[model samples]
Target: MTRLHRRQALRLIAGATGATLATPAIIRAQTPSELKIGGMLPLSGPAAIEGHQVLKGLEFAVKEANAAGGALDREIVLMVEDDEANTTRGVIAVRKLIETDKVPFIVGTYASAVVIATMQITKEYGVPLLSGGSTSVAATDANEPGNPWFFRSWPSSVDQGLDTANAITGRFGAKTVAIIHDSGSYGYSLGDQVEQVVKDNGGEILSRDTYNAGEQDFTTLLTRIRSEKPDAVYIGGWAGDGAMIVRQATEVGLRTQFVGSGSMVSDDFIELAGPASEGFAVATLYEPSTPNVYGAEFGKRFEAEVGQAAGTLNSLGFDSTSIGIEAVRRTGGTDSKAVRDMIATGLADFPIVQGPEGATAAFDAKGSVDFPNFIAVIKDGVRTLA
Candidate 1:
């Protein structure tokens, strides 16, 4: 075949020969001497412990990519910002990451509220954001415009709520469930979804209680819940507050099954309340050991790296980081929009940590993991999947 010396032929090959065919400059820019993937996680206040877990996941991905010859022949860079678990701060942090740091991609913000705020920023800039955190109905429920560039690394509350309800009522069959929340969108929204699932499944909610996130004492709610004496409790809140609720409820002699949302599966929750964390279960997207999967190996690697069992955040971070790097490579450059599209349609059955085990799905259209999640239980302060 004769080499195409025409402009139309070149344009057809690269799809818009605008700035693309500027090969030398494109390659030089593609392998950015300083390519930074921004990270925004709550590093202060109640959710600080989770920030470290998610950060470790990001670091591990960066290290792995760099060791394996990096993406697009460029070294990895990380620009981190703390959202403090506040929505306003989270949006601002992401804006800085976009305009100031000039990071083409981002991953972070554990709180759904914080991620929602950052979503506005990423949408404005058209960057591909793969969050190691953030799971709310509002975050991915884009029936109208949709979050075109927003991809989540965890399962949504809708999935978890429906699944948890099925696991509780359909599989184990919870009779009477008491729903609890911490007054944020995270707790209340998820609690509401779970409550509907239980009610739909013929289980009655004995009582629904709401508390402030930072409040250490939940004696009043615990007292009321203990009085009702439900068969099980569906707890919702940040890791810190959720831990407190469990400890207080256990102290007040509430012998109900304490089931928490995704946030409750973190090491922070267990470490904060110690023995009080026993008997609590959390529904989350990733499991440390589930046959031949990256979740188990990532958990092992993280344990070696951090000297402890990986939390929900750690498990998710590994998946998100690996997916993000691969997306960049598959797209063949650091174009944010291409990577975002790759994340959307490109992650259908793609595997991560693929030496011995199989692949891990990064994101589906709904911005979910598109994979099975385990119902992890805390028995004697150790996390084991049920």
Candidate 2:
């Protein structure tokens, strides 16, 4: 398809809006010579490390796809925007990608709220969004067939919450639980799911608290949790905050077992928490020890190119990009509706990096990946499947 040029698209948009163009678009519309895909990520602020990892993974996939003759007989171009994990920024970034860069599909936005906020813009533009990081069930609820533009690669918060809650009650024998989470959609929903599971399993809720995203000092909260004498503390937030909380909990002598989900499964948490990360159990999809054949090869290439071991975020990014490439290849073009249909109803048992012996990623009716969840424990500073 021949899309509008930058100047032409700007003129069309300006004419359509019946308003003066405030500023020129940062990136011009995709040229007819190359196929373009958009990515919105938290490349700054607290989630920079994760965003970089996802970017690296996407880069690797693009390079590989290009080497394999590219998708739709054109080089796959990935244009990214730094959402900074903020909703307004995410909306702006996605809008720029669609209206300015004219990307037919987008692939990211780590924070759940950012994904939720950007969905409307993608839908309005008739673009598809494939996310690897955002895991809130609310996002899944929004991606039904009635609005089939958003598809997620990662398991939902509900799945991870259930796994972590079961680990708390079954593995740790925790009768009383305390919860700490950020005020974001991901954290809040995770906390609710964990709390409900713990209650369903006949556990007591000692305390539930919410904190800002990058709050460094968890001393007061840890002290209160210690006094409450809970058997386990479930933390739902990013890796940096999770590390700080566990470290502070240990310092304040809160001896209960520490459990977490999503970002807690990251090495950044362990490296930051140091010895405090010992015995920390987290729900995760990726484990370095057990990768499928394709994943193992991808990990080796990823380590060589990125100069580090690949994590869950990287794997998720790769998987999401793989599906996008496949969709474009199967459809023979980057038409948004065609790609969305290829993913939602046409895809079947597409291989991915996380799962059983031969793990594959496929979307359910609600656009959630049909995959199993597992609990991994940080034993002796290594994340091993439990």
Cα RMSD of predicted structure 2? 8.5
Model 1 lDDT at residue 130: 73
**Candidate 1 residue lDDT tens string, 347-369:** 76667432124444545445655
Best by TM-score: 2
Best model per lDDT: 2
Every candidate's lDDT = 0.71, 0.78
Model 2 pairs whose backbones collide: none
lDDT of 2 at 344: 78
Segments in model 1 whose C-alpha atoms lie over 4 Å from true places: 1-32, 143-147, 170-172, 352-359
